[model samples]
Target: MTSTESSSRPYGAFPVRIGFQVQPQHAEYGQIRRAVAAAEEAGVDIVFNWDHFYPLSGEPEGLHFECWTMLGAWAEATERVEIGALVSCNSYRNPELLADMARTVDHISNGRLILGIGSGWFEKDYQEYGYEFGTAGGRLDILAEALPRIEQRLSKLNPQPTRNIPVLIGGGGEKKTLKLVAKHATIWHGFGDAETVAHKHAVLDQHCADVGRDPGEIERSVAVSDSPEKVGQGLLDVGTRLFTVSASGPDYDLGLLREWISWRDEQNK
Candidate 1:
C-alpha cells in the first residue's frame, strides 16, 4: 500500500517501550539468558537481539550466536516482555518463510512478538553465508519487494498471529526507507541525535502526506543516550514513544536500563 493510505488505526497510550539489543555475537547462551531474565524482571518493555554472524563491536571473533534460533529460545524463556531481533535482515531468508517463522514465535510468546526488520547490511554476514552482498541501493530494492510478500503471507498463514504482530522497521534513509515506514511500519526505530531525528520525523510526515496517511498513526522510536533523566522529557516532547538503548557483551550493563524504567514510571505517574 502507498504511504497515503492510512493502513492502521491510531496507536494506543503513549507506550514507554524500552528495548535492549542484547548483542548475541559476543556472549554465552547462559549469559544471554541471564541478561534477558534481568531485563524482564527490571520491567523493560521489549527485548531485542541483532541479526549478525560476528560481533559488531570489540573482537570480531569473540563468542557469537545466531538470531532466529535465539529468538525461539527467548520466546519460551521470557514470560512477560515482548521479544524479537532489533532488526532482522530481510535478505537473510525468504519473506513468506520469514512470516511463518514470526507466526510460530508469536504463538510461542503467547502473542508478544514484534517482527523488527530492515534491509540487510553487514558485508561479513553476506560473504560468510554465501549470499551475494549486493549494493546498498540493490538491497533496499530487494527489501521494497520483500515486505509486501511477507505481509501477504501473514494473511494466508493457517493459525494467524495470536495478536496483531507489530511490524517494526529500523532505518533512516530518507527517500525509500522513510517511504516504506510511512506505508507499512507500526513502529519506526531510527538512530541519530535529537535534531537529526526531528528532521527525519518531518520527512516522514511529508511521506505520510504524500501517501495520504496520518503521520501520527506511525509510532516514532529511537535509540537514545542511556541516561533518561538527561534526555527523557526532551525526547518525549518530540513524539518519540519508544526509546531503545543498545548494550553488548561481555557485561550487559543494566544501570541505564534501570534508570529509564524508573523514568518511565515517573512519566506515567
Candidate 2:
C-alpha cells in the first residue's frame, strides 16, 4: 500500500462520527419519526434510513414507507444531526429527480442532507416496481451514468442547495464503485469487518490515484453491529471514521446508539 493510501486516510485526524440508520420497516411512521428525534438527542452525528419498498427483515411484506418522503419529514423533525438514506438506490428514481429531491431536503434541513446513493440491488423492489431487473454490471453502469447528471441537476435547481450537499456513494466494488466515489462522493460507505474494510480502503486509494484525487478527501463509513469495542476499534484502526448502526422500527431502541455515542466522544476526546 502506498503511504497515502495505506494508513493515512483521515482516520486519526478526522474526528470519529456515529450514525444511526432507522430502518423504515415493520413500524409506524410515528415510531420511525420518534427514533430520529431520539437519535439526534443521543448525540449521533447522522441519522439514516434504507431505501426499499418493503421490509428487509422480519416480514417480507411488512408495512413500509418511501425513502425520500420520509427524509423530507426527518429534515423537518430533526435539528442537529444530518439525515439521509443509508443509501438511496439509483435504480429507483430518475437521476435528475433524485437530485432535486435531495436539494429540497437539503433546504428543509438547513443543509443537513447527505445524498447517499448506490447501484441498487434488491430484486424484489425492482421486480414489483416494474423496473428492469438487469444484471448487476448493467445496474452499476446506470449508476455511473446517473451520478454526473445528478450533480448537473443539483447545480441547475431553482434555489440551489443550502450548501454543496454532500454526495455519499455506498458500495465496495473496487473497479467501478470506488471510481465513482473518487469522482463524485464526499463519503464512501461499505460493509465488512476491519480486515475487509482495510482491503477496500487500499483499493479505493488506488482508484483515487488513478483518478487523480486525494485519497483522504473522502470520508470512510461502515455499517456496524455490537459495541464500538467489538466492531468499531478494528474499523477505526483501519481508517474508518463514520460508523453507522441500524435500528429496526415499531419501537426504535436507541441503546446501542447511546453506547456508540459514548465511544465516539471518548475517541474524539
Candidate 3:
C-alpha cells in the first residue's frame, strides 16, 4: 500500500472488507432474519440495520422493526460477520443504557458487535418517540457528550465488552463529527464519491494529528451505490477499505453484496 492509502492508518493495513446494511422495513421479521443469514454465508465482513422507527425510503408508513431488538436476535443467528446499526441515533437512548445494550449484545455475539452511532437527523423518529427534536448543532453536541459516557459505562459493565467493542461513528460533518471520530471511533463511516471522501480523510487526518492520535488507527468506511467495478477502485485508491452496500426488504437481494464480496477478495489478493 502507498502512503496515499495508509497515510491515516499507520499501525497495520486493513484488508478490503465488505459490509451489508439490511434495511428492516417493508418486510417480515422472518425475511429480515433470513437476509442476514444469507449475507454472512455470501461473505460480508459486517451486517447492519438502521436505527429508526419507520422506513427511510418508499412508503413512509411501511412496516418496520426496531433496531436493537433485531440486533439481539442477529447476535444469536450469525456466527460470523460483525453486527450493528449503520448509525444508531445517539439521542434515542440514554448513552449509559445504550452502552449496556451493546455489551449484552456483544456477549450474545461472542464479541461480533460494532457499535455504529451518530448524531441523528430523522425528525419523525424524534417526534414519534417523544425525544427532543433539537437543532442539528444541538444534536451533535448531545452526541459528543454521550460518546464519553458510553465509553465510561462500557468500562464499568459486568464482564466488560469481549473486546473494546469497536465503535463506528457515522457522519461527515467536518467539524464536530470528524473530531469525535479522531478521538474515539475505531471506524469512521461516511458518504460521498472518491474525491469527497478523500477530502474528509484529510480533514480527519488533521483532526487526528491535533488530538495526538495515529491517523492510521481509524479505518475509513464508505457506502456504495453502484456496482463494485464502477465505484470500488476509486474508493480504494484513496483510503476506504470497508465498503458498505445497502439492501432494503422484502427480497433483500444478495447479488449486490456478492459482487462487492468478490471484488473485495480480488482487491485483497
| Candidate that would win on TM-score | 3
Candidate 1 residue lDDT tens string, 1-269: 12122123243245667887788857788999999999999999999998888888789778999899999999999999999888999989999999999999999999988999999889998998898998988999999999999999999999988977898999999999999999988889998766677788889989999999887778888997649877776666566778887778878889888888888888766
Superposed model 3: Cα runs more than 4 Å off? 1-12
Query: Model 2: per-residue lDDT, tens digit, 51-136?
Result: 99989889899989999999998888888999999899999999999999999999999999999999999999998999998999
Clashes of each: 4, 0, 4
* lDDT tens per residue, model 3, 159-200: 888998999999999999999999999999999998899899
Better of 1 and 2 by TM-score: 2
Clashes of 1: 4
- Candidate number of the best lDDT: 3
Instruction: Score every model by TM-score.
Output: 0.94, 0.96, 0.96
- Candidates 2 and 3 compared: the better one by lDDT is 3
* CA deviation > 4 Å runs, candidate 1: 1-13
Candidate 3's error at 238, in angstroms?
Answer: 0.5
In candidate 2, which residue ranges exceed 4 Å CA deviation? Answer: 1-11
Ten-residue segment with the worst summed lDDT in candidate 3? 3-12
Ranking by lDDT: 3, 2, 1
RMSD list, candidates in order = 4.6, 2.2, 1.7
User: Candidate 2: what lDDT?
Assistant: 0.89
